[model samples]
Target: MAEVAIRGVHKSYNKVPTVHGVDLSIADGEFVVLLGPSGCGKSTLLRMIAGLEEITAGEIAIDGTVVNALEPRERGCAMVFQNYALYPHMTVAENIGYALKVAGTRKPERRARVAAVAQSLGIAELLDRKPGTLSGGQRQRVAIGRAMIREPKVFLFDEPLSNLDAKLRAQMRIEIRRLHQRLGVTSVFVTHDQVEAMTLADRLVVLNHGRIEQIGTPTEVYRRPASRFVAGFIGAPAMNFLTGTLAADGRIAIGSGAGTPVTIGVRPDEIQLLDAPLKGTLDFEIELVEELGTGQVFYGRSGEMEMTVMRNGGGEAALPRSGQRLFLKIPMTCVHLFEVESGRRIDLPPSRLAAE
Candidate 1:
C-alpha cells in the first residue's frame, strides 16, 4: 500500500485550464473517491496520478517518491477503467493473469495466483469463459482480477461500474469494497455518481470545475457542506435552494421582494411536514409528489422559490398532492444559509438574529 500525495497540481489543455492548482493527500490503504459532475476534472486527476497524463505543474508523489517523471508502468499503479478492457480472445483466467505473464512469471505460479483471486472474487467457475461469453458483472470481475494480479502499490478505478445496471452496480460496489478491505491497497476512484462515491469512499474529495470543494468523510461532507454547489451536488434529488434575505436568526422570507439577498439550502430529508400552522411554519404550494420506495419527494414552491422535501414512507401519508397546500416547519438547525455572492456557508448563533 502507498500514500498518494498531490501538491498544487494543475492541468490545462490548449492553454485553457481544466484542473486548477489542487492539493490532496491520500493515506496508505485508504480509499479516496474523486466526485463531481462531467467536466469537473476528476478523471484527469486520476489519470495524472496513474501517470497516464502528465502533470502540467506541481508535485505528485506515491509512497513519498515524486513521480512526475515516471511512466505509467513504472508508477506501480493498477488501473480499472470504466469499460472492462478485457481481451475477447482470452479466457477469464488468461486475462486475469496477463500482467503476471507479461512480467515473465512461471506458468504454475501464475495459475495459482489467478485461481486465488478468482476464488476471492467469486468468479472461479467462470475462469475458462471468454469475455464475450461472460455477464457484464463477470467481465467486470475479470477486469478487476487483472488489476489485482499485479498487486500494485495503488489501485485506480475510473468509474469501473458505470456500464452495469443499477442492481448490478450496487452488487459490484459491495464486491469492490470487500476487495479493498481484503487487499488493503491504497485506492483512488473517480465517479460522478454520488451514491457510488458515498458507499465506497473512506473519504470523498468533491471537485467543482477543477477545484477541490471539500475533502472529508461521507457523513461530514453530507452534514456540513462547505458551499452551495457541494450542498446541492452531494444529495439525491439535490438540496432545495431558496433565495431570500435572512429576516431573523432562524427565519428566511423567500423572495427578492422584501428580504436580504442571501441563499439558503435545505436537504430534502430535513424538511418537516406540519400538522397545523405553527409560529415558524410556512406555506408550500405543492406541485408534485413522487412515491419513492423509501419515502416520498414533494416538489413545491414557497413564493417563487422551488422546494423539494423527501418525506419518509412509501405512500402518500403526510404529503399533500398536486395543487394542494402544505405547512412545513423547516428546523432552524437544518436550515443552511449561504452568502449571496460566494455561495459559502454562513453559521449564525440562535441569539444572533431577532425571532420571527
Candidate 2:
C-alpha cells in the first residue's frame, strides 16, 4: 500500500486546459473517488495519476517518490478501464498471469498467483474459459484479476462497472468493495454515478469543469454541501431550489408575480400532511404519486412552486389525488436558507427561527 500525492497538477491539449491546477492527497489504503459529470475532467485526472497523460505542470508522487517522468508501468499502478480490456483469444488463466509471465516469474509461481487472485475474485472455476465464453461481470473480474496479479501499489478504476447491467453492477459493486477491504491497497475510483461514490468511497472528491468543487466524506458532502452546485448535485430527486430573498428581519421570501413568502426549504422527507400550523401550509395540486415500496414520493405544484414530498408507508388515511388541494406542513428546522444573489448558504442563528 502507498500514499499518492498530487501537487498543483495541470493538464491540457494544444494549450487548452482540461485539468486545472489540482492538489490532492490520497492516503494509503484509502478509497478516494473522483466524482463529477461527464466532461468534468475526473477521468483525465485519474489518467494523469496513472501516468497515461503527461502533466503540463506540477508534480505527482507515489509512496513519497516523485514520478512525473516515470512511465505507467514504472509508477507501479494498475488501471482497470471502463471497457473490460481483456484479450479475446486468451484463456482467463493466461490473461491473469500474462504480466507475471512477461516479468519472467516461473510457471509454478505465476500459476499460484493467478489462482489466488481468481479465487479472491470468485472466478477460479472460469480459468480455462476465454473472454468470449464469459458474461460481462465475469469478464470484468478477469480484467481485475489481471491487475491484481501485477501486485501494483496503487489501483486505479476508471468507471469499471459502467458497462454492466443494473443488477450486475450492484453485485459487482459489493464485490469490489469487499475485494478492496481484503487487499487493503490504495485505490482511486472515478465515476459519474453519485451513488457509487457515496457508497464506495471513504472520501469523495467532487469535481466540476476540471476543478475541484468540494472534497469530504460522503456524509459531510451530502449533509453540509459547500455550495449550491454541490447541494443540488449530490442528492437524488435533487434539492429543489426556489429563488428567494432575505428580508430585513431574517425571513426568506420566495415567489414571482403575486407569489407567497416561503422562507424555508422543506426536504421531501420533512414535509408532512398535518392539521397544525394551518396558516403555514402551502396548497398543492398533486400531479404524480410514485410508490417506492417502503415510501411514496408526491410530486406537485405548491402554488407556483414545484415541490416533492416523501411519505412513509402509512400516513393520513386520505391519499392525495390529481388536481386535489392538500396542505403541506414544513418544519422550520429542515429548511435551508441561502443568499439569493451569491447562492451561498445562510448561517441562520437558532434564536431567530424557532423549530417545532
Candidate 3:
C-alpha cells in the first residue's frame, strides 16, 4: 500500500488545458474515486497518476517518493482498464502471470502466484480458459487478477465495470470492495456514474470542467453540498431548484417577483405533502405520478416552476394521482439556499425561518 500525493497537477493538450491545477492527498490504503460527467478531466487525472499521461505542471509522489519522472511500470501502480485488456490467445493463468514472466521470474513461481490470485478472485477453475470463452464478469475478474498478481503498491481502475449489465455491475462492485478489504491496497477509481462513486469510494473527488469541485465522503457531499452544481449532480432525479427571494422576515418567497433574490434547492424526498395550505407551504398541481417499487415520484409544477416530489412506501390510496392539486411544505431545515450570482450554498438557522 502507498500514500499517493498529487500536488498542483495540471495537464493540457496543445495549449488547451484538460485538467487544471488539482491538488489531492490520498491516504495509504484509501479508496478514492474521481467522479464527474464525460470530458470532465477525471480520466486525464487518473492517467497522470498511473504515469500513462505526462503532467504539464506539478509533482506526484507515491509512498513519499516523487514519481513525476518515473515510467508507468516503475511507479509501482497496476491499472485495470475498462475494456479488460487481456490477450485473447493466452489462457487465464498465462494472462495473470504475464507480468511475472516479463520480469524474468521462473515459471513455477509464476504459476503458483497465478493460481493464488485466481483462487482469491474465485476464478481458479477458469485458469485454463481463454478470454473469448469467458463471460464479461469472468473476463473482468481475469483482468483484475492480472493486476493483482503484480502485487503493486497501488491499484487504478478506469471504469472497469461500465461494460457489464446492471446485475453484474452490482456484483462486481461488492467483489471489488471485498478485495480492497482483504488486501488493503491503495486504490483510485474514475467513473461518471454517481451510484458507482457513492458505493465504492471512501472519499469522492468531484470534478467539473478540469477543476476539483468538492472532496468529501459520500454522505457529507450529499447532505451538505458546497455548491449548486454539486447539489444538482449528486442526487437521483436531481434536486429541485427554484428562483426565489429571502425576505427580511427570514421567510423565502417562491418566485423572482419578490424580495432579495436567491436560489432555493430542495431534494425531491425532502418535501412533505400537507393536508391544508400552511403559511410556509407552496401550492402544487400534480401532472404525473410514477410508481417505483420502493416509492412514488410526483412530477408537477408550482405556478410556472416545475417541481418533483418523492414519497417513500405509501399505499396507493394514500397517494395523489395526476390532475390532483396539493400543498407542499418545504421544511426550512431541509432547504438549501444559494447565492444567485455565485451559486454557492448559504447556511441558515432554522429558527430564523419559523412561520410567522
Provide TM-scores for the models: 0.94, 0.91, 0.96
Q: What is the lDDT for 21 in model 2?
A: 91
Best model per TM-score: 3
Q: Comparing 1 and 2 by TM-score, which wins?
A: 1
Please provide, for model 3 over 1-356, each residue's C-alpha lDDT reduced to its tens digit, 9 standing for 90 to 100.
Answer: 99999999999999999999999999999999999999999999999999999999999999999999999999999999999999999999999999999999998888899999999999999999999999999999999999998999999999999999999999999999999999999999999999999999999999999999899999998998888988999998789999989887777877765567988999999999876898868899999999997998999998888999998999877788799999998876787888899888887776886662
In model 3, what is the error at residue 124, expressed in angstroms? Answer: 0.6
In TM-score terms, candidate 3 sits at 0.96
lDDT of candidates 1 onward, in order: 0.89, 0.84, 0.92
| Most lDDT-accurate candidate | 3
RMSD (Å) per prediction: 2.2, 2.9, 1.6
List the candidates ranked by TM-score, beginning with the highest. 3, 1, 2
- Order the candidates by lDDT, highest first: 3, 1, 2
Candidate 2 contains a number of clashing pairs equal to: 0
